[model samples]
Target chain A: MLILHCPHCDRMVDETDLHPGGEAHLKRHGPEADAEAFENYLFMRENPKGVHFERWRHVYGCGKWFLAARNTATLEVYGTYPAQTHQPPQTIRDTITERQPGWAWGDFR
Target chain B: MSEPVSALRGRATSGSVQVSDMGLQGMISLRCDLSFGKLKALSKDLVGAPVPALREAQVRNDRAALWMSPDELLFLMPHTEVDDALSRIAKAMKDQHHLALDVSDARALLRVEGPFAREVIAKLAPVDLHPDVFGPGQVLRTRLGQIAAAFWMTDAQTFQVICFRSVAHYAFDLLEASAKAGPVGHFPRGT
Candidate 1:
């Protein structure tokens, strides 16, 4: 089973203690947005093989939602951050880029 | 009022583990922003100790507050004193954004004690139960077998596991089965 560090509790918790949320940092499209944009926001996903960002809730532990950046194929978690932010932190992106050369994630390289 | 029946009233001890239903205890599920200075002080006043840190517990006399999550805690005391405890806490936090509910009858508590207690728990829980990791006063909320449960280590050889009243029988059965199976084959190591 995968183990993730919950930023809120500062503990390395098993996957069983967590609930996986879908892709992270998705901008919400409300009534102000066009139909196509709203549909894409709801139905579309990156589904990338590597370097994905996702949301996770430490349901059984801290019960706080957090974001995780990781390589989907290797399951190597780059880092975990609080869920309140609208985007991944720059330090986490830099670390990912350093670890996986030439890797790029949405709005980050 | 009708008397409450224990979940494991007539279970016989098996192997080195002894499981006993703790009967009824006052349980209050409390939720608040612990980071707020005033609320933190109020919690301490209510529980007679500071809010526990992370998975830890703050115990004083016969009362305790187990940290269930960043924003949640479980207050436990003698069953007869639950109502008083609830009212006092409610009055203290009348102006705060908080939720407190008396959950004394909503869950059942089972106590497991013996030299093999850790092993018995290890078989059904994914947590690392090494002495260094989960010693006395540490509490955790996780699934025991297929049912969600919370438990705390009261001493070296004893643990208190709490699950919803609806699943108490299933939890007891699972624990009994694990106890009868003897030592767990593998201890979970950090992944």
Candidate 2:
């Protein structure tokens, strides 16, 4: 079973205890945005093979939503952080950079 | 309101494992920033003890507060004491971004005791029930046989499992089946 470190509970919980919430840090598109922007916000997602950022909920644990930075291919986890921030913490981005050189995700490169 | 009847009635126990409905107990879902000094003081005053930290529980007399999350606590007391507890908590948290709801009737409490208590629970729960890892005062929010449940180890041989009242019977059945199945070999340390 996949184990994920839940930042909220400060515990490494089993994957069965968590609920995957798809991609993380997506900018919301309101009525003011163009059709293309709205469609991208709703339907478009980055299914990259390398470094990726995603959202997960410790549903059966702390019941808090958190973000995880990991490599989709190698399953190497960079870090997990609270989901309150709109962007990943700089420390997490730096860790990803150190592990997977030249890797970029969203606004962090 | 009519007197609430237990979901399991008289059929909860099986073999060495005794699963009995705790009946109607006062339950309050409290949410607030515990880091706030005022809130922390208010919680101690309301629960008659300091609020529990993560994955921990603080017991004061007949009442106990279990930490459900960073910002949430589940307060347990006698059913008769719910009104007084809620009013006190609400007044103290007034104007704050806090929530205090009386969930006494919405849930059911099952007391599991005896030697095989942990083993029975381990059959259906994914949690590590090893005594060294999960001992007294520890609480966990998890699923038992497809039903959402929260439980706390009251002692080495006793666990109080709380689940939604709607699924009380279903939960009891699952617990009984697992209890009768006896201990499994999956747990390395054994209960």
Tens digits of per-residue lDDT for model 1, B38-139: 756766766787878888887776678898888888998888888887888788788889999999888998888877788888788878777778777788
User: Model 2, chain A: how large is the TM-score?
Assistant: 0.94
Flag regions of model 1 displaced more than 4 Å. B6-14, B38-47, B185-191
Best by lDDT: 2
**CAPRI rating of model 1:** medium
Question: With candidate 1 superimposed using the best TM-score fit, by how many Å does residue B46's alpha carbon deviate from the native?
Answer: 4.3
Give the distance in Å from residue B161's predicted Cα in candidate 2 to where it truly belongs: 0.5
Candidate 2 lDDT over residue span B1-191, tens digit each:
88766666645675877888878778999888877667667667666768788888877766788999999999998888889988888788787888899998889989888787888787788777777788787888888988889988777777889999899999988987887777665554324
TM-score of each: 0.91, 0.91
Residue B177 in model 1: lDDT: 83
**Candidate 1 true-interface contact recovery:** 0.70
Error of 1 at A14 (Å): 1.4
DockQ of 1: 0.63
lDDT of each: 0.82, 0.83
In order, the first chain's TM-score in every candidate is 0.94, 0.94
**Colliding residue pairs in candidate 1:** none
